[model samples]
Target: MTPAAIIEPPAMMELHRVWKVYSVGPVKVPALSDVSFQVTKGEFVTLHGPSGAGKTTLLRLLYREEIPSEGEIQVLGLDLARARRGEVAALRRSIGVVFQDARLLPGRTVYENVAFVLRVLGTPRREITARVFEALRAVGLSARAQAYPAQLSQGEAQRAALARAIARKPLLLIADEPTGNLDEGMAAEVLDVIRDVWAGGTTVLVATHQKALARTLRRRTLTLQNGRLLKDEG
Candidate 1:
């Protein structure tokens, strides 16, 4: 018998009535409740809310790190809830993430750290070199490729993390409080790189509490409060 042709996926990322609940000692704690949103190609969006408002929970759901308790999440056309382990891994390859900390491997050089994901995903060595350098160049860290994480400045390390995320040319980029650890000026610089990534056609979703910075970016803002989506402003 002949095998069926594979169907291509539509939107890059999607969330439908998603909910996340944490069980602690017979009590249920809800982080996200019926959150529904979609991020298309080339859009820049920010999730703004105070701590414990389900911002991180929502981002985690999109990244497939945490499964929703009540609804479905489709990323790159893969149903995260129903996907096999290998399928989920493949789905994650198309998503990039930046956490509050740079989270670079301490001993590895900037280049190696940026190339780590590509190496794990079995990209060819030659292609890894080319892609790593290109990503570093995109984040303005090509000159510091050989520097260790400890040797670089905070901003430089964050930029290296950014380079790592974009090295694979992911369709969606999720950042959770990415600027939380940087100073105002350094945060702006990081935001500039994020804007560049969005301009390059990757959808961006940033979870941050910095209202001023969010306004400066002029992107759509999804405000969350008490585990609920309060406002979506464009």
Candidate 2:
């Protein structure tokens, strides 16, 4: 009898029994404990928790900003615990990250801020312009390309920041508290842009403390509390 081959789904991110502890002199502060989950390619996942619930820590682990104290993490097929510095750097280039703050260059125009990332990766000048505009257009910020960061409203600045993150057309997009600083209406606006990006086939993981926001996303939700995963609702 011929045996059939087992088909496994492609994984964009995986974490197995991961733990993270920070040492503060004589005390050890545990940031995450025994976390385990998997995010397959082209899936939209949400991480929801209150402040101090380790959502940020988990996202940091995904992009290799912080290594786990124990267990394993593989992102984009690279073992984060064992990958070399260069390998980690290369992996990060394929992953886009958005923080609570817009984090755009204050002195630069929105166009320049978005173009800067591509330029750092050695993208040609001609390509930079096109790519920047494409990303800005995706976030509905194309008309404000020449405006400085300070000239933008809170929502516009956040959109500009999103344009910068997606400029590289990353394989995965991770956002941590992306709408933390915005009002409810503004937050919805930013989240809609994120949803649009995910719909465009970029794997996405959003970390937020808002229950309403998580419900709005309507995707697989992983809930974290006090560094422990309490629920994974699909």
Candidate 3:
């Protein structure tokens, strides 16, 4: 669809009475029921819940991979309902996402994996070189820049994923269970990388079933249960 004139959002995000329903055969199931919330710029937040509680669904909607069945979602000043293809693409470019498994390219070196995103965004070679190093340094993986994903340990792979996400210096980082596959020690390492990025002023939203991680981060937490918001604690 064609985009409308850009309208600056009043906040970093605004979701009013949002609902997301999916069709499985004939019956419809709700993934998010009347979820309404906003995230302020540069704020760190967590969405923690057990499986099937809509955390991932909510993140997908925010990133524009899917649209809510009902309600308004304005993120980073772009109205999802009205945002054109280019607008959505631009919006996504401003956000970074990480998954439970470090989705690094098996064949690419760590530095190339990080550089891919910048190349897609048309960044200059010199700037990409600087940013890639900066990101790798932040994740403590400078020495492994030439290592292939398959050669790295799980922890190193996750660190490389973090470096790739933060290389472009996106405004928002949405990590969906980034440490889900890690041991406590490895998870702690990943969390440290996230904390460093947050300290650098990137707004972050992490989804995890691990309650302790949320508490350890000492960030605001939003809990979802069976598609409904249950609790919000800081």
The CA lDDT at 148 in model 3 is 94
TM-score for candidate 3, please give it.
0.94
Point out the higher-scoring one by lDDT: 1 or 2: 2
TM-score per prediction, in order, is 0.93, 0.97, 0.94
Tens-digit per-residue lDDT, 112-203, candidate 1? 99888899988888899999999999999999999999998888889899999999999889999989989988898899999999999898
Best by lDDT: 2
Tell me the tens digit of each residue's lDDT in model 3 across 1-234: 999989854477888999999999999999999999888887889999899999999999998988999999999989999999999988888899999999998889999999998999888987999999999999999999999999998999999999989888889999999999999999999999998899898999999988788788788899999999888777
- Runs in model 2 lying further than 4 Å from the true structure: none
- lDDT of all the models against the reference? 0.88, 0.92, 0.91
Residue 124 lDDT (model 3): 92
After superposition on all C-alphas, the RMSD of every candidate to the true structure, in Å, is 4.6, 1.0, 5.5
In Å, residue 233's CA in model 1 sits off its true spot by 1.4
Specify the poorest-scoring 10-residue window by lDDT in model 2. Answer: 117-126
* Tens digits of lDDT, candidate 2, 139-221: 88889999999899999999998998899999999999899899988898999999999989999999999988899889999
Candidate 1 local Cα displacement, residue 128, angstroms: 1.1
